[model samples]
Target: MIPIRDTAPCHSRPVVTWSLIVVCTVIFIVMQWLPYEVSYRLIHLYGMVPLRYSNPDWALAQGLPFDGYLSFLTNLFLHGNWLHLITNMWFLWIFADNVEDRMGRVRFLIFYILCGLFATYLQWYFDRTLEIPVVGASGALAGVLGAYFFLYPMARVILLPIPFIPFIFNVPAIAFLGIWVIIQLHNATTSVVFKGVSVDVAWWAHLGGFIAGILLYRYFIKPQAEE
Candidate 1:
């Protein structure tokens, strides 16, 4: 289901969220203009490759860039294609503002980066042998979804469950995000148990980020008077 928007209102301007969206969009445009080979190499260098960090020597032998731990954060700014970028940015735009409003600008930024890092590492843990470069802001955005789930469990969400039919409906935040997490869990389990299944999405990363956001959000939440 595609989320159209949410009912939760934010009193504070989401500076960090807007800035992140602009930066990701600009980076995506720059990536599209770069030569194919350069773009490919850039993604490898910046995008998180589980094997790159898992087996540093092997990665170096294969001529893959091993830039310490930078990719964990850098990968959040990279996207494989236009569709990938758009989907992530769309989710971020919808949910992140409310999260940033509650956490404040600097704290939200820090929370985002930390959640992305946690998500990347969890992905690496699942399949350290995989050499494919993992890119996109979904993991971090998953964190925002997590925060939203907690902060606005009753907030109404507009969803388009049937794309072609254009049937939209309102659902509670808890039900919406609950279903999302369940789908991720099911896919993650299926991928691990069935080796032949070729699931491209980072289900584990999404799950981990969501959980992290739930656990860490209370620490960053502003008091009632402050809000």
Candidate 2:
């Protein structure tokens, strides 16, 4: 289901959330104008490639900086295409505000980066030999979705379950996020079954990020903080 928005309200401005959307958007626009070769190089250099880090000698042979660990954070700002960028930013727009409000801007930003890092590393563990570059904010955004599932379980979400039908369905946040988890789990298990096949999406990253968020959010959230 395509989540349009959530009924939960943010008591404070979601500065970190908005900043993330804008930065990712600007980076994506700049990437679109680069030459194909340059763009491919940038995607590989900046995106988290499991094989690149797993085998330092191979990475050096490929002219990649073997010691560079910055891709763990950089990959969150890079996306493959318009759909990828749009879907991730849209999910952030819908759900991140309340999370930011709960955790505060600085904490929210830290939480996001940590989740993304954790996710990338987890993906690396499962596909250490795969040469594909894993890019996009989906993993980090999955973290936010997981936090939202815990933070606002009863909150109402407006969804477009069927786009062409123009139907709007309102459901509990838990239900929507639960469906998301199921989808990720199913895809991750399927990916495990076909181990040799290279897949475009990082299903394991999604599951890892979601699990990390659920487990780590409480530590970030400050219940007694001022509004």
Candidate 3:
């Protein structure tokens, strides 16, 4: 199920969220226009590789403070392809605004980065031996989805059944986000059994972000008085 939008009322404009989306899109567009070698180099330089980060020798040679320590932050902005970039950014657009409205600009930025950092570490911990580089903002976006689930559980979200199917169904935020989390859980579990080798994508990062988001929401957002 794909989320089109939510029913929660957004207060002030989500400057930080929109700006981040614009920045990511611009970076992706520039990379797309560049030659394959340049684009590939850019992703490698910015993306997070668990093995590269876990090795102190390589980190010393590359002048990095430590190996995987820094990749957690850099990896959030990296994407493998146009499709990856677009989908991640699209989700960011759909869900981030309301989250930012709830958290405010500065706090929201911190929340996003912190979630991304924690999520990346979780992914790395699951498979530190893998050399494949993990990239994309899905982990952070997953955090946004998690927050929305709690911040506005009663909000209506428009979901698309398929690419062409125009089924405009409104579901409660809890159910919507719950289904998303379940889907990710299903895929992550099945991947372990079906694929002998781990996939490059960081499914655990998505899970970690979700848990972090849920916890953060409970801590930061106070309960409103019932009408």
Candidate 3 lDDT tens digits, 182-210: 98887777766786855656788898898
Local lDDT at 79 for model 2: 96
Positional deviation of 45 in candidate 1, in angstroms? 0.5
Q: TM-scores across all candidates?
A: 0.96, 0.96, 0.87
Clashes (candidate 2): 0
Q: Is candidate 2 or candidate 3 better by lDDT?
A: 2
lDDT by residue (15-41, candidate 2, tens digit) is: 999999999999999999989999999
lDDT of each: 0.89, 0.90, 0.79
Off by over 4 Å in 1: none
Candidate number of the best lDDT? 2
Q: Candidate 1: what lDDT?
A: 0.89
How many residue pairs of model 3 clash at the backbone?
A: 2
TM-score of 2: 0.96
Candidate 3 residue 120 C-alpha distance from true site, Å:
0.4
